[model samples]
Every structure is written in structure tokens, then in C-alpha cells.
Target: MSVQQMPEATVPGKEYLTFRIADEEYGIDILKVREIRRYETPTRIARTPVFIKGVVNLRGTIVPIVDLRMKLHLHDDPHYGEFTVVIILNLLDRVVGVVVDSVSDVLKLQQDEISSVPELECAIDHESIEGLGSVAGRMLILLDIEKLMSSVDMGLVPADA
Candidate 1:
């Protein structure tokens, strides 16, 4: 029902979208993703950070877009093609949008291929990075949606009036 290339994952019945964030490859659980939309004309807010590119209409609900590239000061490779997609993620109890260069295919990483993040960095690395995973010789970083979705930086709240 969606036209998004998620991480290349095929672990038994589990899968994830492995994508490149700058030079790093990261993956998020395919189930958490609501939908991926192509680049839309975002309405610029009068005053806001560059990463926060305002909101867009998804069906009829408004969803915010956060530029993952700008947030990490990562380079955008035009080779990946234009019209970057906005990944709708369901984090915590809210739905947030993440701007990605391009949606990569679903990855199939075995359980053994996944590596947990170092405990030493757990105390200092608060960048929403969950852990690292390896697939077919390539390393894919897993995203901790729980940490990323409820991040104070995004300031997302319940969508109830």
C-alpha cells in the first residue's frame, strides 16, 4: 500500500529498512513506519530551525518533517537521486516525520549479525542511535525509535484536542 524502499532486512520473518545517513547505514523496524511520501512543498514557518521544515497534509492530518541530513550535518549525495522521501515514524505515542535521502530496500540481517551498542557510550551517546547491525558484509545501524521519537529536541506531544 506504500511506495517506499525500506531497509534491506530478511531475518526469518523480520525486516528493516537499511538506509544511508550521510556515510553511515542505518535501519529502522519496518513496522514502525507509517508511510513514505515524496518531497512535498513544505510551508516554511516564520521562525524555526532549518531542520524543522514545517508540516504537510497526509490524507488530512498534518505531519511534521525533520531533516535528518541537516540535523546531523551530513552530506546529501545527489547520486541517490532527487525527491527525498519523508519517513513517517510512530514514536512513543506520537507520529513524527524524518527526511531521508532515499529509501533503501529491506535488509535481512540475522540475529547474530546484530551488535548491541557499547555500554560505555550509553552514558554519553544520546543521539538516538540504538545499536549497530551487520548484513551481507555491510554494517547497518539500528535506530532506537523509543529514544528518537520521545526526544525532547523534537518536542512532539499527544495529538488530542
Candidate 2:
């Protein structure tokens, strides 16, 4: 319903790192993501959302992994094992990791080619998603990283958490 969700308003043909949270395809700005890391056993934290696996040490920085499925209001328990993947993203100049069902691939969508989200009664927090971008009949949900971190109350660390 906001101006941000208008597909034609998004920058087009720009490459985005696409991934899946459940069956839905989602993507973040490729430049905002640092790298794709495999799920490693992380240090468990107390009093956090179950979807939050824990913290991981990337080089010397401590980053938290957010279960994208849970964040998206989907069933966090995955039906297929192949969907487990952790995507490291740089948000609001802060770096963090997100756990997703699967990493599909990178895609390019141009401005004016994207589609705005239709009015729905669903409970998804649209502030984190910019719009839906598609290519070759395949669609991707654009993500807003700055909104994601704040929504979970996770603050970016200077060098470590």
C-alpha cells in the first residue's frame, strides 16, 4: 500500500542474491551481503527467539543468525533438508547473518519491471520487503535489511558482539 512496494519504483536489472525462506523466493541487495556461509554450530544465547540459532564468529566479528522462515511468519521447521542455508548480510552498515531455507541464485530486475504486492490480509511485516522482482517467470521478494535488524532488536556491533 506504500510507495515502497511499487515494483516499477525499484531499480531494475540490478543483480540481487536470491534465496528462499520457505517456498517463497526472497532477495537482498547483492552488495549489502558479504558472503554465503554454511551452517556451523554456533554459540547459543539465552532468552532469544527460538528461530535465532545463535552467534557465529566471522573472522573476529560476532554475528547473529536469524531464521528467515520465522521472520517471515512461515513454519520454521523445514520439510526438506536441502533448504537450510545461512546468508550473511550487511544491514544499515551493520553485518549480520540470516538463516534461510535455500539459496536459489542471483537475479537481475530492472525498474518498471517489478510488481507491487497486491492487497492481502496476510500478517507478513511488509516493512522488511521492498517489492517483488521477477525474471523469466520466476519471482523474488525484495528484502529491506535495515528494517530486518531493527525488527528483531539486534544491533550491529562495532567489531564484535
Candidate 3:
């Protein structure tokens, strides 16, 4: 099909759900997001990573809750406040929730708005960074949420799963 004849949603650009962690803004593909819920205490699991806050029951499904701040090592002692929220994501046929400081607005960015990520030595896996998005004087660290969440260290999914 011709570019003009294609659906708007299938065009060159994509929409992202922007959120904040510490002072930096990050984004993930909007399609990965299932829902957003208020912060709630989850049932703690033994012998799990510190980043794995616990599991929460979501409509009969037990969903693992990950704290982005702790997972990315952004904060040594992360504080859960009123603005903290859980972003439920549909990943690899599994439902998982990630806690973020607060959610920003959704942005529909064209390909040109995204720039390649610069090489940097950091705690976050560089591969998980999709690109750097610049829009309206704001810069967003676009993430490949699936890659980040499915990595071996995360233990969210098995090698075959």
C-alpha cells in the first residue's frame, strides 16, 4: 500500500507513554501499556530481587511489581509517595506492573524527533534504550520495555518463554 493510503497508526512515527523517574523523563511504546493503577502494597515474595517489590492480584491474575527506581538503580532509597503509580504492561503474553515516580503525557513523535542514544556507561542496559526523543524542548529516554523487562536479570520470562 502507498504511504498515503496506509492507516495513520501505521505511519512512520509512533506514540509513547511518557513517565518520570527521578528527574529524568522516560518513555515506552504506548501499545505495551495495559493500564495504570494507584500504588498499592503487594504481597512480598521470598528470594526475589530487591527491585521486585512483590506481586499484586489483578482481576485474578498475579502480577509482579517492579520498581523502576530500584531496577535501574536510580535511587538508593526510593520513596513511595502519592504520585507513585503502577504501569501495568502486557509483555510477551504476560501481565507485569512497573512502578514509576509519576506519569507524564502521551506524545506522538515522528521518526525525526528521535535521535540515537549516545554510548554511556550506566547501570541501565544500553540495549534497552531505544533512542533519545526530543519534543518541545523536552528530551525523553525512549525505552524498549520488553527487552528491559525480559532480560535474564529480570527473571520475568524464561529463555524459552
The candidate that wins on TM-score is 3
Clashing residue pairs in candidate 3 are none
lDDT of 3 by residue, 131-154 (tens): 999999999999999999998888
Please report, as a residue range, the 10-residue window in candidate 1 with the lowest summed lDDT: 72-81
Best by lDDT: 3
Q: TM-score of every model?
A: 0.75, 0.79, 0.91
The candidate, 1 or 2, that scores higher on lDDT is 2
For candidate 2, write residues 32-133 as lDDT tens digits. 878987777679899877767689989999988877676666885644365576788877666678887678888777876577877676645677677888
Candidate 2 Cα deviation (angstroms), residue 86:
1.2
Q: Model 1: runs farther than 4 Å from truth?
A: 1-13, 75-83, 119-127, 158-161
Q: Ten-residue segment with the worst summed lDDT in candidate 3?
A: 1-10
**Which regions of candidate 3 deviate over 4 angstroms?**
1-11, 159-161
- Clash pairs, candidate 2, are 12-109, 12-110, 12-111, 13-109, 13-110, 83-101
| TM-score, predicted candidate 1 vs. hidden true structure | 0.75
